[model samples]
Target: MAVHHQASIVPTKAELLAAWVPRQPWAAGADTSSLTKLGSYRFDDPDGEVGMETHVLATADGQVLQVPLTYRGAPRAGAEESLVTTMTHTTLGDRWIYDALHDPVYAAVLASTIATGGHEADLFLSTPDGLVLQPASARVRGSGTAPSAPAAGWSGPRVTVAGTTSRIECDGALLTVLHVLETTTASAAADELVLTGTWLGQDRPVLLAVLR
Candidate 1:
């Protein structure tokens, strides 16, 4: 489960995204004057130290994009390149944000989720009263069976971003995360492990990631 504090966050999520997203290579030449958040989903870090959340946004030009981010209490070593920015959370204090693609914790949880057929984390609000369940803005499921071993020869996650997708390779395993989402009727390949998501208006599952 992911616990959200009921405190103000400086440079709120939308403000941070507005300044960062448009500068990404995939979002080059895109108009974001009216960029609006569509939905978001979260995955729990096994250790519960880092916060993992993926936000989906729609640009004024009708382009839909997904950006995954990780929040840490302190800066991550050797991850300066992936660092988005730093912000102060009224309750939690300072936080260092980085693109999830370069965060090993995210890659590990993502791989485990796909390998064990896991779903998105449950949401809860941390209030003075106690923990309160919150409705998820989006949901996701991995297409994999239980009782499976890790991918063959898996060493660690190596990420590469090109165009509108991020490719993660772990030895022989390959997982592609779609940054730009599109509606399609195509089916997944037999050997591929897929991740699909659904939101309020989008009851139909849409492709989010694929592990091969």
Candidate 2:
């Protein structure tokens, strides 16, 4: 489960994205000031130390993009290049944010989720009274079945961006995130496992990632 505290954050998520996203290679020339969050989903960290989430945003021009993020209490060593920004939380104090593509925790969870045909974690809102179940705006599912053996170990993800996609590889697992959502893409091979999602307006599943 993913628990969200009912607290305020300085430099709110939208504000942070506005300042940082426009500079990304895939989002270059994007007017992020008007970026609209279409939906989001969460993946749980087994250790429960870091928060993992992926947000889908639509540009002013109607280009859809996916951004995966990880939140930490302190800076991650050797991950300076992936650091997105920092923020102050009313209840959690200072927080560090990094692109999830560079976070090992995210890679491990994503790999496991895909290998096991898993769905996004259940969302829960932490309140003074207790925890309340919250509905997820976006829903995602992996296409693989249980694996017989564990994947080979890899240190972290090596990411490369092309025209409209980002390729991420780690621990012998290759993942391709479609930064720009397109419905006319070629069909996936029968053997390839993929991650697909649906949101409010989009009832048809949209290809989000492919695990090769």
Candidate 3:
């Protein structure tokens, strides 16, 4: 289970995005005037070292952007390029946040989750007295395209973007991380894995990621 902290965060998640999202080349047209967080999902690390969370932000213009982040106690070595920001947490202390794609641990869990058809981990809030269950945002699920060994680079190590979609080329499969989700139906091809997100009252399946 992923325990959520009810303690204060130095810089709120929205504040960090306001400073970092504008710098992204793909978010050029994004309306940074306001960033409303839609919801977030979590993945657990088998080693229990890194904290993985993927946040989806909605712009004023109805654009949905996905930003996966990995929190580390210390600075991630050799990931200076992918570092977003660092902040002090009342419960966890200092944390280094980096783009999930640049973190090997995030990639491994993400790939494995997709290949094995996994769901988001259960989350509970850590309180002063004890742990309390919190309402999760939405449901997130994944399915693997090509069934194979879920290794570290099963979905490639480096990241590249094609238009609004991000692409990661692995040894035998290609993974696509959809940055901007569209409501239109997506044509399915043979041997493809897709991750979807859903919210209350909204039954539309938003394609979050794909692997083929």
TM-scores for every predicted model: 0.93, 0.93, 0.90
lDDT tens per residue, model 2, 1-212: 99989899988999887777788887774556578999999999878899998999998888778889999999999999999999999989999999888787887777777778888999999988999999989999888888632374446678888767778786667877777786444357889888888887888888888877
Worst 10 residues of 1 by lDDT: 148-157
Q: Please list the C-alpha lDDT of all candidates, in the order they appear.
A: 0.85, 0.83, 0.77
Candidate 2 wrongly placed segments (more than 4 Å): 29-33, 147-150, 183-186
Better candidate number, 1 or 3, judged by lDDT:
1
Error of 1 at 65 (Å): 0.8
Ranking according to lDDT, highest score first:
1, 2, 3
Candidate 3 per-residue lDDT over residues 139-166, each given as its tens digit: 6777654465365454237678677777
Provide the lDDT at 3 for model 3.
89
Name model 3 segments beyond 4 Å from true. Answer: 145-149, 152-156
Query: Ranking by TM-score, best first?
Result: 1, 2, 3
Q: Give lDDT: candidate 3, residue 11.
A: 91
Estimate the overall C-alpha local distance difference test score of candidate 3: 0.77
Task: List residue ranges in candidate 1 displaced over 4 A.
Answer: 148-156, 184-186
